[model samples]
Target: MGSCIICGTPVEGRICDSHQEDVVFEFRGNEASQLTPGRFYSGAVDGYADFGVFVDLAPGVTGLLHRSELDRRLESLDWEPGDTVFVQVKNVRDNGNIDLGWSIRQSERDFRGALVQDADGDHEDDESDESDDAEAEVETPTVRHGSASRDESDESNESNESGKSNESNESGKSNESNESRHQRDEAEPEPSADRERVEIGTLGDRVGEEVRIEGEVVSAQQTGGPTVFEVRDETGVVDAAAFVEAGVRAYPDVDVGSVVRLDGEIELRHNEIQVETEALVSLEGDDADTVQSRLDDALRGRARPDEVTPLADHDAIVSVGTQLQDAAEEIRRAVFESRPIIVRHTTTADGYVAGAAVERAVLPLIREEHAKSDAEYHYFDRRPLEEAVYGMDAATNDVTRMLQDRDRHGEKLPLVLLVGTGATVESSDGLDLLSIYGAKRVVADAAAVDAEIEESTDVLVSPVLADADASDLSTGALVANLAAAVNDDVRSDLRHLPAVSYWEDAPQAYLDAASDAGYDETYVRELREAIALEAYYQSYEDKRELITDLLFDNGVTPDGDGENAGNLASHVSEQFRLKLDAEVETARANLESREADGVDFAVLDTDAYTHRFDFPPTALLLDELHRREREGDTFVTIGVAMDELYLRSTADVDLRAVAEAAREHAPEAGITAVGIREGRIEFLSGRREQVKEAVVEAVAEQLA
Candidate 1:
């Protein structure tokens, strides 16, 4: 029998069963079922897939390391095929499928002890065997009456030596003793001369050494084994895990955003630096104020830019600088507080491009702020709205989901960001409901916003209010600039988004920006067409990964004509043209031209002439038709439906003015400008005849 290396208890092996999981093992087993779950093992990288990496645990025994299990992005891993790595056996399914988990310790030296494991059982190291054999060679002596006195001296000396030996076995300290030590450390006052306080950014240099730090608690979460508190100092943020007891809460009084002084030993967990917190105490009164002051000073110096610089030299962009700063600050605050950010954008090419730019900029910051791999999905969501309006329907869905998340998972309510929408009076009801629930709202659009919307949102970015022609800008261009202000690291990646937003004539500034970022006019057109095609197919789902692949991935060959050399835009654009051209041909054949009150008009019964539940909705179809059929005359295309009417004009038609005329002409029709920017108006179905005649007359008068 051998003594347990951890507790000095006699056992069949070197370590007791209770400590089996604490030591790393080298597996000699051939079958997958022989591996022990929750035990670390040495493995080698096999290959990578879109979902995860394949790891070979033993000869002919491979397991999957899913991307969700990784602490960092799968693409960022610098592993090559056959490179040795360490992982934990999370499970071995009945079908012989092995599941691996990430391990912080990639080297054997990081583990406390190493054991050789096999199909039958585990074995002690060679050094333990040698020591056991030597101990067995010692002989025992018999006691006599006269020799009792002399034996007493030897017995006393031996007892003293045994006690000294036990004291030297610090690694085998009992759990009760460790708990007592932690209690004592917690009760002790702040150190005066033992160790100087260090900045979190410099923790890498002081790893494995005890240090003191003063910071604010950003977040506190309990795992099955420890309570991890994310602490942030002026320099950086770090997670300090405290393990007083399994599944027990630590530092019950220290809550989020509270200033505290902590003492801990720096350690690496999951390939990231973390602190093993030995002691933590809340800083109160003057101490708290001092820490807050220091943090605020540092944040002011580094957190945001001094002034908002416009991406392009435009007067409207310059005028909205203050609002842009507010929006950027709000987004940054949400990230720091661990609050989720929900982006609601219209389901159009321009809207998707704008939303995608924000996604790209914010995801990296989310990943950096939180340790969990799924934090990106939890903290950032990009949802597509069917129309450019945040009405009661969309607001209800968002509030319901957020309320559920808050009740079920104890998550904070998310910050709702309306992109390319929610900046008009039509969406005021939705904004008011969100405000009543204390949810913050921000609007980024290129449309003419209502004056009331300015008061409804925390930050509003609308170029039309600043005297710049909204027609010359796209939502993508404005939000792209906002995204740059949110995170400067992604500025270069977003430079091409503005040009992609324009379907026909792009402003020279945006075109120049795209060109500077290496996208020419043809490439820009291809990207626009490809995105438009994809947007139409999955109108509801925000094809985030696929869109990212098409726009950002340079190595992807969508055409498959060359070895990773063909552009994705080239392939998707072909499909876009084929589908769009067919629809255009059908629309042209059914078009009817008429002149009323000396005004030329092209009218189509959209419900009867076009595919209702298919690609190119009424707004997009009319936009495309006007571009093709309008021949410089004062022309308007009225797409009539059962309950609604869509008006598109070659000349600049004031939708609000037309709506006023229609309302006066047919007061009972309830005509309203629902989509003024799109040159669209809605009419009640009950007064279809009255509304249709009024709309036709209104168009003629406006054209005249």
Candidate 2:
């Protein structure tokens, strides 16, 4: 039988060989076990070593107890390197290296002492006997270690005792050296600060310094003080103040659960850390939110150079913003750090108010960008626009009904935009007119444009056309300021188009948007070079000499008369091609570049998150309403689909009142404006403006 390396005893029968490589395994240090791959251990030792000792954790599981694992103390002679050790398995290597650990340094000390006393000098029995009572009399010692700082003497002892080996008269001492390590099992430690209190100095000594101190609240009395309070950190407590405080005044009224930091001097009273007469703040607030704010304030005050350093690892951070400028900055920072950021908008009133203001004020600045683009802009709406269309149901007569009703021939449609009258311009000047019209119309969605374009049939003027390059400069590119100045629809339209500027005389701010686009460099170069040269232009006599010069040199001149339909068609085709090419290039580059390593950048599919909304828990009250309807106990008994009910769940409206209103309005055919999520219905007015108000008021009244 192979000898157990740990206990120096021979093994019997089939040796249990655990074939787990790199897996942590624990066993008694005294067990007879052979060294094998895939097992690690930690334990008490029975001997000392110059290098390290062999610890046999179990049958076929042995690890080295290196001298580097010994504890502090020049006088420590309890354990030897090769003797039986009470250990914990950490990791087992393939090449037979076993990482071991000990819960307490005393274990190793006791084990080493046992081995030293047992070692035989010429007389083997003397070594073996060692007055058996001596082994029985040794008591196991206990110790604790944590992140908290320890006594300087303890560290000094460890450093000094690292040299030297315990010599024995029996067999020559083992070769392994020893080092000290302390480990603790996962368990809540009992509080022991009451037994002995340590005096750690005042703020000056503790500000940048770290010390362990325990204190008791003598009195948590509050005063009508400023919006500042004192709370304790590990080192000490400090006064935490804030800008807002009218609500916090009385201290005795505060709850006992409130824990505050002390700011100034630490007065030792009755052998406990205590402080008095400092600023006080209430930790108690409405809920967790108040606590979180207090804690955040404390953390901000207590932040130190060391704590700020990430502990080698941590979870990623997250930030949120609804404004484009703020979002862009946040995104840029996240990208720089190579950290993933989950963004969400804070649906507070500030965001909506600011968004509405931005929508109204910024679009006007870039009026030229939306000229020709078939893009659509979406402005911030206090309520969903879809709801507004359904709110216009007050009218009774046919004409009024037609105007008020969202449903026309069972087709639930929304409001029609009242576009300004078309301008009359010659075919040559038609370019400017088309540019102006397109700039205004393009930012609107394809659906909105299609609807509006179909209703109007009269043509007051022929189409004015410009070369492809001039087309963008003359009419396209609605700036944020200019777009925001017009109606909400105009703002929505501007969001859909790219900003472009052709003439040097164009708005400087509008040109900035074009320059921001990736293609601006190419456009700028062509315009400058062509404008300086005479050969690029066919005639200076042409009313559009400057336009001709810019276009011909830039290869933007059409194949037919500048006003011809063929020219307009060609220009549109060229613009489409250029846009398509740019989009394709961007896609190809994204696909070709390597994404961040080890990070899966897949977008979370939202199909599952939607299921929660689809299946809401049945409230007893709602069930009662449904039962009443079934029994014909309720009026009108309007029937809504499952999704509508689900959408209404998040709404402020009362379900019972909505049901009652629907029942009452069903006969009169009072309109029910379905939300955007509804597939069959489209409201006429802005959903947010009209429908949301009615639904909220009606539901809230009923619920109340």
TM of each candidate vs. truth? 0.71, 0.17
Q: How far is candidate 1 from the true structure (C-alpha RMSD, Å)?
A: 12.8
With a 3 Å backbone cut-off (N, CA, C), the pairs that clash in candidate 1 are none
Per-residue lDDT tens digits for candidate 2, residues 1-704, read 54222222334411223212211223423323333323333333434345655655554545665644433221233455455335545566667667765323221111111111011111112322443234225332112121111121111111100001211112443322222111111121223322332332254333332233332221121111112222333233332221111111123222223543222233332222323222233333353355446444543443211111111111110000012222222222222111121111111111111222233332232222211111012111112121111122211111232222211111111111111111111111222332332211111110111222322212111112111122222212212222232233344332312222222344444445445442254455343233222211221111122232233223343332343223322343354345434433332233211112221111111122122222111121122222332321112111122223322222223343454464343423333433221211222332323332333334444544
Kindly report which residue stretches of model 1 are placed more than 4 angstroms away from their true locations once superposed. Answer: 1-195, 336-338, 366-375, 403-412, 554-565, 663-670, 683-690
Residue range 1-704, candidate 1, lDDT tens digits: 87654345678966677556545777888999889999888888999887898999889899999976775557668899999888999999999999999875564423434567788678744554554354335332111111221122121111000001121133655423555446534553443446667998788788778889998886565332344567888777776765433223455556667798988777664466777676677888998999899888877665565677666665666767777788888887777666789999988889889899899889998887664445677679899998888999999999998875553233567899999899998899998888888788999998757767987888787875566666677888888888889888888888888889988888888888889988888888888888887888767777776688777764165332335656678788888888778887898899888888877788887878888788777777887888888876687888888777888877777778888999999998889988765666788888887887898898888888
User: Candidate 1 has what TM-score?
Assistant: 0.71
- Error (Å) of candidate 1 at residue 123 is 31
Name the best candidate (by TM-score). Answer: 1
* Model 2 CA deviation exceeding 4 Å by range: 1-146, 149-208, 211-259, 262-511, 514-704
